[model samples]
Target chain A: MNKQKPSQILKTTFFSFLLIALTSCTKKSDKEVSLGALIAMTGPIESMAPPILDSVRLAEKEVNDNGGILGGRKLKVTVGDSKCSAEGGADAAKKLVNINKVSGIVGALCSGASTAASSGVAIPAGVTMISPASTAPTFTTLKDNDLFYRVIPSDAYQGVYLGKLVIKQGITKVALTYVNNDYGVGLANSFKASFEKEGGKVVTESKHEDKKASYRSELATLAQGGAEALVVIAYSDSSGQTIVRQALETKRFERFIGTDGMASEKLIKRIGIQGLKKSFFSRPVATKTSFSDAFDKNYGAFSKHKRKSIFIKEAYDAAMILALAIQKGGSDDRASVKANIRKVANAPGVEVGPGDWAKAVKLIAEGKEINYQGAAGANEFDKNGDVAGVFGHFVVQMGDSFKQIK
Target chain B: MDTLYGWMMYILSLLTVGGIYAIMGLGLNLQWGITGLFNIGVAGFFAVGGYASAIVTTKFSPNHLGGFDLPFIVGILFSMIFSGLMAAIIGKICLRLRGDYLAIATIGLAEILRLILKNEVWLTNGPRGIPGIPRPFEDLAQPWSEICYLLIILLILAIIFYGFEKAINSPWGRIMKAIRENEEAAASTGKNVENLRLETFVIGSIFMGLGGALLTHSMKYIGPTASDPLVTTFLLWVMLIVGGSGNNKGAIIGAFIIWTVWSASELLSGILSYEWINRLSYLRVFIIGFILQVILQNRPQGIIPEKN
Candidate 1:
């Protein structure tokens, strides 16, 4: 065994290399139009990736089920794991663009990955990229050459919408806390600007980082200022849950408010509905027809966390919309996909809802316009390729669930 | 033809990232192989370099942020300087200790540095990070800009490798080897062993920072995730050891080999559909660990041993 050590190691290396070579020889056929999905398969928010990819695949299945895309060509989706970082994004985008040679991409959920992949790889390669959940306002001004777009509303839009809803509830004074990152800061800044303009008082504000053992110090600051309620703009599963539990235990404030980040059933289950009876949350309003019956049924065959999985709706929409663009443009060309994203997702067109692929394709075939009011909502692309979204008010119901107010 | 162009760009990127890792591997080789210092804070120095360059490229004050159009070299120089300064401080405190104690001290300190980079949003932009860093020759047309960037990286790597080789043959290089072999014996000869060790460590750390800055420039973005210890610090150590400690060429070869496998294994695994989703992504990490184990088991002295 000792004498054979070096050769054995070499053999192992050779074997693995051979495996890689054999696995990588998958050839794309001419009858298929490939789109890439750049999701974080490994990293901090890794648990969410597999499910979200399934939702995007669900869109692919939806397209292929109803005849196909681009004059009977099958829609093929190649997956690239962005790993939730800039380097990961650039690396994955390079492979997806070069090796896979996809015309479009969808669902790089992390903002950092989306920006880097867009600017570094996708934009330079002239590939159209649609992020399912990147909400940075910076993208609005990115020199993307109109090749980048997102299904999610900009943080700027959701925050401003939430501010109007807060004032409608007649809460004039409140304490505010948010996780100090791009998502939190963007939403908080927009919310503050809109709330202050609507004649409300943000008596105190504190920004805290995520995954801390305790947020008592920040909570203490928020507890002061004699505010009527405390606002939390953070993910419910982590820091948001900790802050809410600590706040109630300390009896600092009776009323609580949360933004899109806090709109989760986990909070209601973890903290109990009794303690959060007066608490309210805001999320980007999904239309009733959004996540339609067919979508729910199709997605049910995969993960049970349909409502709980973050960005599943947006991921589905992003894939479907990109498919629609390819179909409407009548080609698998990257430039045409970019050129027709707006044409397929905006008003003054034949209305298409989720799972209405057949209807949309028929309209496209007839040389009529098509509009994809998707699983998220009506995705009307603006000059900067951003879609405006409305915020929905939600409250904890008796069954440990969130009931959205229309 | 477009597909062909895309494949070419992909290969260029693999080389680009591999070159960046080779630079960092050289840094680690100097620290561990030349001077016998267990510097475990590679990621800390990396973050310092990346954030330093990012801040230099643009104004990110609380009041206003501006367009980033500064000379890329200025940011790179700043990264190396800041990293060197940080290394100087860390070396002063930890070099007094020996072996594993020094490793523990450096690791703890680096964690503190990581937290500072993460929490201090004004400088590093926290987790959201800074993007749109203009790279040298990025404005040039496709493939050429990429080609130019890769050339600069390889050119830098060659210069550093040549410098290291010359240093190894010089009196300083011989002294470093002496200190590594028998520290007490070298000190008895009044060689100022402490100062020499500190210098080796600081120089090695400077290279780590340089590598980080180049990476940020290549990606045109940086975030807290860029400095993740698993990806940066631990990965560099693997490259150094598997390549061959105390061998400059070994380090370069090691970096290219390891990083190519790391990135390309992902590409290879990308062939697998989501039907095997759970196994696909982790397969890259698994392959890397397997390679490291095989290399360490077969050649503990590395692919290129320190030649007498």
Candidate 2:
């Protein structure tokens, strides 16, 4: 090997990498206050990222158009793909916190990603992170040191709610199956505990892997349990779809119960209304608020898929609340944003909603308080930064829709 | 902090994670490069290490098994021990199968490990995972805490690197190299080839476990998805192969360089248009593959080829 060749190659590669690093270190304009969005752009939730990003962009646009943030400085959002895993989340969040120096973060959507980012990066780095889609029960008890918050409720609460709903419907014995993941496990375990406590019986339980060719053997065992219905705690596009179709064809359990993941139009299209006539699904209901009219009227202009996805409203709420917190705190400091999140989200303030950022800013300037009522609901965050969820019970209608029964 | 300091902090993260991967690269180098043991089941040992470390060190929680709340060194040892035990069992059964067949068995081991971690709710907390694994020096201030953690990782890497170097130069190293080149001839010389192969397998796996434990502590959380084969298994192979597998320094250098590329490519969006930032961000994975292909074409034996 030539002596100069190795050094030449090394120098060339080293300078190029230095160039990339230097380019990324370009400073943010002082006129802008930046935030980070940790969406799952490449992992399991890739399908859900587009609209969620749109919602975040909507919040940014709405805030800028109204009054901007902090006496008319632009509110900029930097995007980081969490990739729906711990490593991805930690890496993205580290870049956001250290390199971009974002005052607050609004994502890392998957629960596992969120947990790692919050505990490992954001909390330690003193940057506040708010997740709109992560619903693992772990965050409720995680020692986040007051730096982590989520607009959505944990799956543990929803599981208990489903448990009570099932008993109220007079269904005693049911065979349960959940796709094995954080969401499925959290919801299923909590539901089982609550159901058993409320004098109901889960005759058999099975946890199956998602995206499988068939769950025939698992279904065979579940079918033998002699149950009133089959509770499928999985997404409609994955294992839930297969289980439902197989159960229908085999004449297993006639009645069925599903969670928000199963409450979709695609289910009716494939299974038809007849097969799902005895089936009902549960989903978190968007509350009727004064802001609802504004969101319904204007959100269509901003987003193509207005109601096509879950957590769009919550996503909007998370970003908007961050902006409001920045305005209320009147500083670009990380600690300021963390201290102000609950102040702007909680009660006893002049109510503000989406597209009303100007009024909210004016209120903050006046040394008055304002509570942000967002597109989703009045997200009153508890001590753990979790909101109490309100779920709706729905049954399949004759056409391609679901009717809220209660 | 200022932008330059921010950049430095990000570099520390790069090295922290990079050092961990270097540990894994060393293990892969020992097994495949030194002993020619085709053990592709690094992900299984990795998960075992992560879960064991997490279970051993975490505070009392109803989730998963352990509430012992042991210290950091204990967590690391447990992770290595558990992974070593798994390697011993699997090596006893499948180490006899050479080359590609061993690859298939290791793949099965990875899948089985992932399934167990996902399904065994009472033990491993199922897929919800055990959160809040302790990080040493986390109680200190920002840059210092991060500095200390990175130092600890580098120190571990140094010890492992030193140990491997000593081992690679010893007479035992010559015998292992002999076995790698001509296994039948080495066995004919009565070097106890099977035991040496098993020893190499178990020792390499012990380092992989250490890598996994370090990752868990740094990330402060672990789940089944975090141990995805794409990152854990395939990436280790690329690192060792690109670094020139025969030498320990190549393994270390390859890990740092590859990880730097893997991580810094995500920041390319800083120069792109706002509309293209999110859309073009995925080109990172493509960029890594492109670089790997370019390097393979230029230098098949890697950047620092084994010096005979």
Candidate 3:
């Protein structure tokens, strides 16, 4: 038995290596112009995926219908679930960039997932990945080699907006507890920095991990310093619901503030609307333009009765922008498409929106550049591929729905 | 030809990931298969190893300790030591308990460590984990850098695997098996079962730590999510059980099989019809569970059984 061990191991390794050698001979055709969407199809952020995915699908369908990019080559989206985690995001990105051979990727909804996907696979593979919902401030300064971009503004902007909103509401002293992760910490730190700069006292600050059974102790720690409100930065389905429920159960803090992650009716249902009495949250709002209207018209039926998440419009815009860039770039090459992203999305061009796909393609073909004012807003991507977005301040109403507050 | 090479590179990457998981599974196999020690907090030790190495090796991260900027080799060593030390502490307390108690303790241990990694921002930098970790031979160009890293990891895995095989077949391994089979009997024979169990746990954890460090270095990023207990611990357990808990080769084989299936299903879901994509995502989980069920029902000793 002992003598056979080495040979058995050698045989197994050899066999597995042979399998790899055989599989490597198989080919992936790059005939179709495929755009990959990396989203949280499963895991903690599953609730937010459907609308984003639907929006991407809607864009792909619309593009394919409208004579597709680069002389009638149909546009397709290969959807890979980021699983809203680092390792999962890396794996998803690997499949998209390597196996599927997508020209461009729109996705990796969470900040950590985005970071993981970009750094681990996307950037290394030289595949362009534009995130729709990743808002960690760290993303603003990532060493992406110009391969990464985001339609949504970083959390720094949101943090400043949240701080100003809090100050406007006369909330000087607030306890802050954010989910412990890239999104949570980035938002929390930025909010704290901005709020302190605005002369608002952060009475206490704490952080909590996701999927914990109870956070009464964390709440107690935050409440110890005696704050008027709690600013919670976390996803609604993950730590946000638990924190809100625990706070209400303990009756530690009545008034709560949340970021985009907590801006959902799902949160209201998790911790009853009655439980979220004086709570309000901030999220990026879709511009009520023709583009937004077009999105609602296209995806509204598919996403019937589901509460709209913050990044659905942004997701639509991300897909549309990538497709438009591909059209404008007039090439199937990844690098050329990446180069045209800023040119087509930014300023000094004819204005275009969601309904102008064919027109936009026509204009680009005629050598006249067109700026894509997407559903999110005038998506004039900065050098970093980030666009400034409008923020909505919403308060929970009597019927478990959020009514946007002035 | 480019497409074929792309597929080859993709497989190479997948194998790299599998290699790391196999190392982790091997660590778990040593504990559960050979010593009858159930350690579910594999992620905790992994996190400790990863974070320790990340902190020590990288230039100081703002809001967290850094600036040590040790070499990659030093980072690997630091990770192993840190993880082994953590296992020693955890083992001292939890090893007294048996079976389910140990499982619960380990689960809680991993959860607590995850919480610590999250909330202790000044230490672990909260959720904005340490990124931009330097891979070995990173200065090398494109495919070469990756290929070099893969070769290095393969060499490391080979060493660990060979050493493990040697250790398991030795008198120490027999004693471990004895303690695993009948702890009281081994104790009556003056084998010092508790001490032996502690040693086995620590040694196994050292490999796990090295695996974690390799993962962090390879990805060149580490976050709380990277060490997620469900992804790391549970998945590794499944690999061990599926591969054959008592068989070292089985552990490595199980890792490759399960990880390949896990990733390949995601690719399949992407290719499927739009209407079925969402359902297929859930079905992927079902497939994994179903595979486990089938494996358990048919080959309960796993595809490769213990060579007793």
Candidate 4:
């Protein structure tokens, strides 16, 4: 009986293993295409991830509902939160690539996280990453690798836009308050250089430590410099909000201009409508594409609110681009999907939105041409896989809404 | 429904993070509350553990510092031992100094360690960090997979906590406390005060290293930024001070509560109107500071003070 028990146990274990493997293989065979998203669902940038994720989901649903990517083969998306930190981003990337075996990924939103994850795991494993919103200029020169791409224009372009905006506003002198991190420092320096080149003067520049309270002294110094306008390049954290509040409370500058990081509704909410009245910031203009409207509708319904974020638009566009690329490549293979990403993203001709993903995919699969004009705007991919878009300056009017001023 | 789920997930994540902090805080509690060793370099030892485990287990290549791809259990064990060795060396050098001088020396050492991590790109990947670490039990099926993994981690943590409680109640623990209270007397009693102090420092650091290793695994990423003195050093001290210095339960509770508050505030700031939540973010830190002040003023012994 004891000898029979050992054989019986071994037989049961083998059968169990076989069943598991067979089930897994069958599940894989049932899916036509698989994609992954690594977003900062928790941590400092967690607030920004929801919009992006919502958009991705919406795009995925549209594609799958329209008879999948490769003719009846459905596309599936697996989401992982990167926590906006380098380590978290890498881990999320690894899970998506190693465990999920996804063909493409959509995020690692923050520059530092994206950089770390791309170098640490994504590039090494040959997984394609296309960041929709990460705008750090250094990404352009990242190890001469082609695996990483961004849909948004680099900070360098944004700096130039801000510089032109400053000139347009006739603000002769500006005071710069930047966070002491790579994102802030890069934007601040670029803005300074562009502004100086455009014959505008930067009165004073200072850096604020992250998560620091009481920037009254720093604002006091900037106010004392007698600059007509103040430009803040920082994230939407407590410290950055405090800096904005203090600048207004101290009555230092006439008007405040900020980068995309400070362009969130959360920033205005933090400072209050009264404080935000005189503030203007540069952000990617939200195009009135059908895809964007659909995303907005879905997200508003999901959040049970009337408002939607800019990141939602970017994320939706990223997912659509990825799906279109897969269809265009004629396969769900990682390398093929990656190679066709730029082709679909920048396909010359008619524009396609989220609702038209089916038609777009069909056309691409049929070997016809297509161009994707996303909810965020014209997604024309350059050599570096970055999209060039128009930057608009908006004035915070009331109730977490902004009035776009050309 | 999604929002509530989001909150629950957030709470779970915070608890996981707090569990790590609790372990590190316990290490601090052992040194300051029991052995009276002022270790301002807590973050340094933690970073050492993370880097050691990462480099040891990662697949090595010619262009990069190759890792052995050893089992994570073995990597963690080695990391703890290495951290203990480093702490012993540092403790021997700095234990002779008393009061603020020792604090300053340890703080300086912590800064030096951070700089080394930042500059040694060839070894530590510089400021960019190491990513794509393998998680234990990742091969399991989904649905209950993550939960099972978390349960395993929690079980390990419980064992460590119970083990620590047992050690603190032992004769060795009593001697360490004796040295803390009256060093000269402990020396006169042939306790070999220096050796005792060094031994305590090493043991405490081993715990810190283990805590760091667990954290890296949970996060699945390790970076120099994670080891920043601001995040590691300040938060660990806050947990230890607010939780009650000498109590294990206090440490765990403090970590959970503080981390919960921190994470909740972040979520709340996202959901609430920007106006209401904006200033609240900055105010959150001050709130913690206020909590610390209140704790010190009202209950100097902490919510769970160490017992004699």
Q: Specify the highest-lDDT model's number.
A: 2
The sequence of per-residue lDDT tens digits that candidate 3 reaches over residues B1-308 is 55666678788888898999998888999999999998898899888888888888878668687837989999999999989998999899899999999999988987887778767878877777877777787777768878898898888888889989999999999999998898898899887888999999999999889888998887777887888776788789899999999999999999999989888888876768766877876787788889899999999999899998
TM-score of each: 0.90, 0.90, 0.85, 0.62
Residue B46 in candidate 2 has what lDDT? 92
Model 1 gets an lDDT of: 0.84
Clashes by residue pair, model 3: A181-B127, B60-B66, B60-B67
Q: Model 1 chain A, poorest ten-residue lDDT window?
A: A21-30
Candidate 4: list runs displaced more than 4 Å: A1-8, A19-23, A44-52, A168-173, A180-183, A199-201, A209-216, A223-228, A234-256, A260-281, A297-307, A393-405, B1-44, B47-191, B199-225, B228-308
lDDT of 2 by residue, B1-308 (tens): 37778888999999999999999999999999899988778888999999999999999778789757999999999999999999999898888888999889888986888788878988889877879899999999989999999999999999999999899889898888999999999999978998999999999999999999999999999987778787788778888888988889999998999888887777755345545655654577677677679879999888888768
Error of 4 at A230 (Å): 3.4
Segments of candidate 1 deviating more than 4 angstroms: A1-29, A209-220, A223-226, A235-252, A263-280, A301-308, A394-406, B1-3, B59-69
lDDT (tens digit, per residue) of candidate 4 on B76-168: 897798789888888888888876888888888867876777556567755445555555765554324445556766777798789889998
lDDT score, candidate 2, position A123? 95
Give every collision pair in model 2.
none
**TM-score of candidate 4 versus the correct structure, residues matched by position:** 0.62
Please name the candidate that would achieve the greatest DockQ relative to the true structure: 2
- Which candidate would rank higher by TM-score, 1 or 4? 1
lDDT of 1 by residue, A178-285 (tens): 988778888888899999999998999999888998988888888889988898999998999999999988888878899877877888889999999998888876
* TM-score for predicted model 3 compared with the true structure: 0.85
Better of 1 and 4 by lDDT: 1
